[model samples]
Target chain A: MQQSESQSTGAVGARSEQEPSNGEIVRFDQVVKRYGSNVVLNELDFSVAPGERVTLIGPSGSGKTTILRLLMTLESIDGGVIWVNGEPLSHMRRGGKLVKANETHLRRARKSIGMVFQQFNLFPNMSVRKNVTEGPVHSLGVAKDEANQRAEDLLDLVGLSDKIDAHPTQLSGGQQQRVAIARALAMRPQILLLDEVTSALDPELVAGVLDVLRNIAQTTDITMLCVTHEMSFARDVSHRVLMFDEGQVAEEGPPERIFGDPQEERTKSFLKAVLENG
Target chain B: MNWDTEFAISIIPQLLQGLVVTIQATVIGYVVALILGLAVAILRRVDYIGPVVFVVFEFIRTTPVLVQLLFVFALAPPTVAPLTIGISVLGVHYAAYTAEVYRSGIEGVAKGQWEACRALSLPPLRVWGAVVMPQAIRKVIPPLGNYLISMFKDTPYLFAITVPEMMFMAKAIGTEAFRSMEAYTLAGLFFLAVSVPSAVIIRRLERRYAAV
Candidate 1:
């Protein structure tokens, strides 16, 4: 089951030279993560294909966001290896045994992954243009003028072109989040992780942010693994949806099957609960 | 013996010269403190050697700046001047306090900001330089300004090493001309002159940027 699932993940991004064809963009091979005595991800196995939009949804502590955090390398695996583009993210092979990867290794692996957080964590000290331009100019060593142009284009894409000079503190929450979206896309990662990106916004502000994301989903071939409680968004934008239960994927299928005709009792209850609350 | 304008006018040049020395020591020492304090804060935050760095910072912060000055001055080479030693002592001593301020400022930054940098795969240096310090430094400015004022007032301790700072010249002028009242009053005025305006500026800055 796991072998075939991983093989399917490897067959995406056929158009890109940087992204190798038939290589899983991200894979969790029996990954385990623990915080002291509490096991957050229990030997989980999952895979996300290049350009595929996958969403993880469940109750608060079901470890859905942890899946995104782990892929982004924000958290480490306690056991098992996580692969990004068929290379280990949390561990490296040495002398025929798996060993923890070093900082250099983690840094190299992290280049292809970008994450947008729930809080729209824009650099409060920087302007919108600077926040978007910083990663490419600093980390990727892109030319300053080119980075500025790209930032302008991205800010336009997110509908924040007029607000580029404004500091994060000066913008409203929705505008700040759109700027953050532009900031993440400026890095041009093959994989983007969205962890409840609109959860922190006011109810009136949520639609604007969601529209930006849905537009990105329709336009970009960037592989996205999102964790959002917005059920309609999961139904609208995702190619596949996985319902997590206590650190493991309890139900997984295409959105129509998962949301329309869930097989598991747990997934039905979760979807029902979310809709009732919404 | 009386409050004589003639004597005060005669000694004004020496007291002004000493005032220059005092201002120089404060500016130079505060710069050192600011830079060294940031370095110490970074050392404490980074992995490996945290406990040892903690102990070293605590020791420097708890001890008297005057005592540390005397000790570092005694151990100095013949080539180094007393002014330099006094400044170094002032810097290292305040560095301990500023280190704590920096740590809190850095900590005051939301965890999401740090996570954002990690997600972007920014190098550790960029994380601190571009993402972290900009936010942290804004928070630390007010406290650090207070320390600069504190260091300025404490420059009198440099008199113990015969650096000829303001207080030293004041005492020298008093002992020589028996005009203790004018010399001491002039020295006090100089200190208040520098300290009051700076404290006001720092307060205004705090109000201006505190929203961040």
Candidate 2:
């Protein structure tokens, strides 16, 4: 463990001096995040290559959602750094040293990342069209006419063209989540984080939201980092699955390897429990 | 000793003039309170000065509007109109209360909404203006309407500072006519007429938005 920590630090230093050597799009080097006395993520080291789809699956309190939250900058890290697209995300280089990032730095780094929440978090006051167009028109300065057109097209992609003028409060949970997906995609983010995007939906509604996500996976090259319990969906869409245990990755490989031939006792039991429950 | 219809009718024109001033004061004062209160609520979110703003607003809220009006009246130059002083003082005094209303409204917005705004990388101003304030203001309408009614009633307190509002006119008519009952009764009727309907409208709005 000590050797791995040193190696991760050395790798971060080398990468900071130059471009990301392996062309990894997102890298977490010795990142530590804690909530009061509880350490949510401890020296977590991982990286996602561009256009790769990675899913995180584990029991509650294993820091699966925390990882996505960190990447989205919803919560600050207690230690180490997160690099997105070869630039420091949680910190900025100031006078040749890494320092905690300010709001300006975080805002700039966050523009390339978009997140969809479990609760669908669509602006209740806005119509579906405005919900999808808001980030593009207001944040990115996209023209209103172009943004509206793009919103209509994206709603069509999510099978919600008819509901474009409907308010989010007027839609079903499944429909709202689809609008949220379209809203995130409207920003044209290079990285998408899904934090239990369907966990709040009813069982019947879950499949519809999952199908929208599956369609996006098939059609877009956007890198996805998802935290979810939908094992079958994870297996189908994920290029790699990381099995988390105690805030660290216990096992990581192709979904088949992790599910069919798990090496760790933790991984074997977790998969057995999940598969049995399903 | 007797109810006099002619004396009451004679005072109507003078009282009407006072009613106009009263309405003008209430409208202008309420606008100032709404805008200034929102500014206070937003400013109180700043880390370093938030506590200071909170304490200052608390000081204003705890004191009576009568004392505040008298204090401002005394401090102002004589050139400033008494009505102007009344409007400014009443506006600021009620702003202290409205600020709390806005603070609760802002806090009532869900945490997920803020996270979504940040995730979209919306600028701080845009986040508050487009997302937070719209939702917050909706939830606050009923409470703010209640404050407006309270503020209208409070306009009579301006009489202490010699502003010619409704109560001020009633008092002047009583002094001139030596009959206090009719003028005072009419002034009370005007307040009831405005306040009751406004309260009903506010109740209807609350019921409607609650369903949303």
Candidate 3:
């Protein structure tokens, strides 16, 4: 099933460079991350299958966002290995030795993954169309005309076709985030990582961005690993939900099972607090 | 202090010729400074050589420009022209200062911009040239213009190395006439004429980019 799904998306570009031995698109085997003396992710283990949608829910310091940051290579892991498409991400094979990856190796490994930041990190120096087209033309070697056309289509999909020429500073927070979404999708990545994508928006503007994301979830076969505070959106889009506590998965199951009838004490208390505050 | 109107009027052609030399040195030296400064700024970010580059630039920044001009002039071969040596020395000296200005501008860019570039898997060259440089250069334009004006004023230092710049011509006129008042006052006026307008332009630029 994963093979056929990846092949269907391969028509956009050369995405089948590596064939996964297992069906998992992303896997962490005993991964550990630290900031000084603080251990953020301690022997964490999880996996996401190809085309699967997974949401990580936890309190502020529970290491949910750290998982996404590690996958994107924004922060390096102190121990263990990360696998993407069944290939080691944090290390590379050199004369039969698994050594830490260099810049060139990391660049090759990062091609299949894309991330949407919470701050909607659009290039303020460029127009909306150029922001979306830049990665495709420069990184993937797509032709200028084709990248421009694809950018237009993406802007239309995000319901911002009229804003193709506007600067990011001119748009509202929600509009900027939609443009960010378009920019991420323009790369044709097999795995998309969303890190509290709508956390910085005004209260009234959250629904519009969520609707755009819902549209993408329904339409594409791309694998999504999302860290979000919106519980209803998580339950609506996620196939599985993981409740994290102290850098470990406390409970994991279908959304209906985890949210409806949580089994762990930590998960129960966490959900109770969230429900009351929300 | 008698003002010599006729003497000052007579030396206009010579002063203009010296002014040409001064303007040439400032423009060429500034071009070199802009390029070398950006290179130094980027090299300072490299892990192994960053500290070495920082110490070398700090040494240059602390010393006097006149001493540097003399040191290079003494070491250069006789085959090289004094003007050539003077221009090179001035360029390298100001590069140390401009490098600091560029460092602040580069650091001023938001951290998220870099993460976005990495997430898109954009190459290092494209990240700097296409995205980072454009934003960094825009924010530093006003400070860069101030450096240009400052470099123009500093051209008088080249007279010590016998570069025959404006101040050199003024001293020659004073010695020939046996009166220092007219020539010295004209030289001061020339600097004011160029610097005041440049300061105004830089102020305007600061206001415009500040709004962005």
Candidate 4:
């Protein structure tokens, strides 16, 4: 079951890297982020090309998740500019001078991106149907009937069709996470940020969510920036795996090379910890 | 002073009339209190000190209800009216308490929930309306409901304002008819008749919220 999915994902990864590299979907130019005196992302330079699947793997507090959050505009970048789909996302050029993107600009840009949190952050008040359809109907200006149809289809894709009427409380952890994935997909975002999506699920439920994500990575055109601890899933689904340590990319390569023959001591140590613990 | 006979006949009608007035005050005052309390509670969530609202809430909660009732009722003219002032005082007074209930209920919501709402980039007003308020309101149902019943019981205090609510009517009739025992007893019964059922509803709401 896993091998065939991996094969298809490998093909998709190959295609994305080799395709016409016209417009970069996301670019981070010398981004630096800090909290109080603690620096989380230091002089980070990364770019996610259109249709690429980039997996960020690192130990806790390595700022892998922070990168994703910054892109989603949940965290402000203390220094640097981010360009999304050729438009500056972090700052706007006002009168030929750069200024921070205000709330209105950020909201408009963020609407094009969807994030799946590790905790699955489903709106507890909404049933699965409402959760999936809210973004599309409200933010994307999709008609209600069209959004409902899309929601049903996405629910089926996540293998949670029966849960559409159920509240977040009624679903299992994996089921709720699946609903969350569907919720993000509803907006038809240009990029999807998965922050350790399966890390919070139980062992038995992990496979189901991973299955849905594998399908997305293979079949969809959405650019994905994923931070995950699942090394095997990362290897199977990622076009490029970036190993982060101390808030910078310690190593980056195609998954096969990164997993098989890591170049950096920090990368080797992170892999050893992951393997020894797994 | 035909104690038993006068008490039995006059007290029943007077108590009944007083009971009606008491219930009206309780219902109206509680409704105002609940709404105002929720508003104050939500306002407190704002990061800014919110323009002396905290002071006003503290003032109401700290002051004695009897004094407030008298001041509101006696000072206000018929144009302003004792009934309106009386209910406002009761509502705003207990609103301070209800505000606490709301704040606690809001705090009870997991931090994860707020982060999730932000992740979705829900507009601020919708974030409150769609995500935060529902959970906060649900968590607070029990305590707010308790306040409602307590406010109902406190309705008798409005009598000082000459509002002619249940307690005042019973006291008046009891003094004039010289049947204090009967009138007071009937008044107690009137309170029980309303408050007991309201208490039952509050308990049921508490249980339901707890189950969730």
Candidate 5:
């Protein structure tokens, strides 16, 4: 199931990962991003292997979400290139010179990646079925019946099959977030970007969303990059957890090593603060 | 000079004929305004040409409808029908205001809504046509209806183009019979009869839909 999803989406987005490139699904090479005078990401470099679940944990404004946003091409990087599935997203090679990508280039390059924002960001104008089906039908030009069938499967996977016709406004925050997850997956993104998916929910609602995500993480071989404040979710769902500080990776290891054992002072301080409040 | 019952009775049938023209002008003029206004609003979102469009919108909006009526009437070809001239004048004038209405409506949709469409990899055309405009136009329907009613009342300004709408008929009757009170009073009554209910219905619609 995971291989088929990856194969189908690989055909949709850009140059497919059918050609091997050393097993890296996503790579950011010396990436620099800035907003006015505030540097959000400075010389950041990281790579996620295909089918690995990586979690980035940090305090606010540590530039973790910025990394996800760059991968999604929601914002362009000021320096360096972002390569997804071995294709350049930030710049295209034209006549052996790197040039900034135009709109068409960016759109095509970004199809392999899907993002779930902190806010649910579901289409308020559409029903849950349409919200999930819209991208496949329009962007992928998939047949309506085929797209509808896939939407049903995804909605069922998220445990919202009963609310297919419900509008986004009619659903609870957690339900809407689940619908958002289904919508992103319907595109069959090879690498799913979860940007603090459970951060916006109420305490009770957070657990439901987390459970759905945990199931996906365990079952799918899709590469996953998540940024979250929920330490338990990070520990449970992630293959590896990276502690981020001031726009760089401070420490990273298997979740057991990062969470159970003490290492760097900054990582120790962040973990202590988060646990104390909880 | 007084409310002459005899003069009022004689002008009633002629005034009714004039009312039909008034109604036709208002309806056609509004369709033109609505389409043109929405076009200008949507087209102005393009970065390369947006400033030029906004300048043109401001120019048309700052000018008076009466002045616009006279200008279009004077410049129109002799072969054109007077009624078409009248409708076009009103259409262009109100379109300026309605264009602003559409701009505010489109912008009023929450920023997150746009980001969702973008993240879905929906093209720009699909984003605006399928997602953004649907929500925006729903919110602006009441305001759009208010402008429709305003355009209906403003049809009287068509007298400059000699289309013989209700007000033109009233003035012509007053000249011939020298009974301004009776003819003008009846015209006001007809306008009152149409506009009051239209306005109340529009207000009710605003309350019903705009609250959400």
Candidate 6:
């Protein structure tokens, strides 16, 4: 089943110059993470293919966001290896040993993965244009002139071109988050991680950010893995949805099957609760 | 004795020179404190090494400033540069207090800030340089400025080592001329001149920080 899933997602981007076909963009092999006796991610096996949109949905503390955090190399896996673009992300093989990847190696690998957080973490000291241009100009070493052009294009894409010179505090929460999305997109990452990107916004503001994301998902070829409480948006935007519970994937499938015909009793209870609350 | 005229005349050059030394010590000492304090603060935040750095600074902080200055000055080799020794002793001593100032500032930053940085996958250095330190540094400005004023007042202690700082000059001139009143009064005025305005500025800065 995993092989088939990889193969399906692999169709979008070729793996390497000589492979003639795309390999997995991200693969987690029985990964586990623990924090001082509390297991955050248990022996979890998940994979995302190039250009595929996968949304993870579950209640708080179900470890949905942890999955995305681990992939972005923000958290280390205690038990298993993670492969990004078919290379180990959490650890490296050094001197016939699988040592943890240091700062430099992890940084190089992270260039291909972009994450948008629940809180829009714009640099408060910087303007919108500087915030958008920061990662590409500093991390990727793109030239300033080129980075500015790309930032301008992204601001237009996110409907914030007029707010380029504005500080983050001046804009509404939804606008700041849209700028964050544009900042992530500026990196041109093969996989984008969205961790409850709209959870912190006002109800009216949610739609604007969601609209920007939907536009990106439909128009662009970038792959995305999102953890969200927006069940309806997840159902509409994602090709596959995974429901996580207590550090494990309890259920996963195409949105129709997962949302409409869930096999797990836990998933059904969660969906019922969310719908009732909403 | 033409006390008023002679006092006013003596101050024109000597007091200016002493003011120059006092200001120089304040600037250099504050800079050294800033750099050393930040280094010690960050070093103490590290997991394994933090305790070691904290203990060293703690010792410096708990000990008397006078004793610390004397010990540091004594530890210097006779052939060593006087300015280096003077600035180093003052800087290292006051840095202990500055480190505590910075630690509080760093802790004042919200946990959400750290979480946001982690979610962004920022390297540790970038986290400090861009996200963490900027906010932390902003918070401690008034406290840090207050430390600068305190360090300025402490410049008198350099007199013990014959470093020829402000107070040392006052003491030397008074003893040599057998008249303590005018020289000491002038020295007191110079200190008040620098410290009084600085204290006011610090209060204003405190208000600014409180607003933030």
Each prediction's Cα RMSD?
5.7, 3.6, 6.6, 8.9, 6.5, 6.3
* Candidate 4 segments exceeding 4 Å error: A1-22, B1-6, B47-51
**Residue-level lDDT for A44 in candidate 4:** 88
- Each candidate's DockQ: 0.66, 0.75, 0.84, 0.40, 0.75, 0.34
Give the per-residue lDDT digits (tens) of candidate 6, residues A1-278: 99985663343123221221245688877678998899988888888878889999887988888888887777777876777876778866554445568978887888888889888778776789988887787677789999999999999999999999999989999999999999888888889999899989999999999999999999988989999888889988899998899988899999999989999999999999999988
TM-score of each: 0.90, 0.94, 0.94, 0.91, 0.93, 0.86
DockQ order, best first, reads 3, 2, 5, 1, 4, 6
- What lDDT tens digits, residue by residue, belong to model 4 across residues A74-94? 888897677788777877655
Q: Candidate 4 falls in which docking quality class? A: acceptable
| lDDT of each residue in A1-278, candidate 3, tens digit only | 99985553443123223334578999887788999999989999888999999999988889999999888898998877788987889877655445678888888898899999999999999999999999999999999999999999999999999999999999999999999999999999999999999899999999999999999999999999999989999999999999998899989999999999999999999989988987
lDDT tens string, model 2, B1-212? 77799999999998888888999999999999999998898899899899999899889899998999999999999999989999988888888989999999999999999999999999988898899999998999989999999999899998899988889999999998899999999998988998999999999999998877
lDDT over C-alpha atoms for residue A265 of model 4: 88
Query: Tens digit of lDDT per residue, candidate 3, span B1-212?
Result: 69989998898788878899999999999999999999899999999899999999899989999999999999999999999988898899889999999999999999999999999989989899988989999889999999999999999999999988889999999999897888888889988988898899899999998889
Model 5 chain B is weakest, by summed lDDT over 10 consecutive residues, at B111-120
Clash count for each candidate, listed in order shown: 0, 0, 0, 0, 0, 1
On a 0 to 1 DockQ scale, where is model 6?
A: 0.34
lDDT of 4 at A15: 30
User: Which lDDT values do the candidates have, in the order given?
Assistant: 0.87, 0.91, 0.91, 0.83, 0.87, 0.82
Task: Summing lDDT over every window of 10 consecutive residues in candidate 6 chain A, give the lowest-scoring window.
Answer: A12-21
User: Second chain TM-score per prediction?
Assistant: 0.94, 0.97, 0.98, 0.91, 0.95, 0.92
Report the C-alpha lDDT of model 2 over A144-252, residue by residue, as the tens digit.
Answer: 9999999999999989999999999889999999999999999999999999998898899999889889999999999999998898899899999999989999999
Error of 3 at A160 (Å): 0.6
What DockQ number belongs to candidate 2? 0.75
Tens digits of per-residue lDDT for model 1, B1-212 = 46888888888899889988998999999999989988898899667787789899899989988899889888999689999999998998988999999999999989999988887778888898888888888888888888888988999999998899989999999898766999999888888998999999989988877754
Better of 3 and 4 by DockQ: 3
What lDDT score is found at residue B45 in candidate 2? 89
* lDDT (Cα) of model 5: 0.87
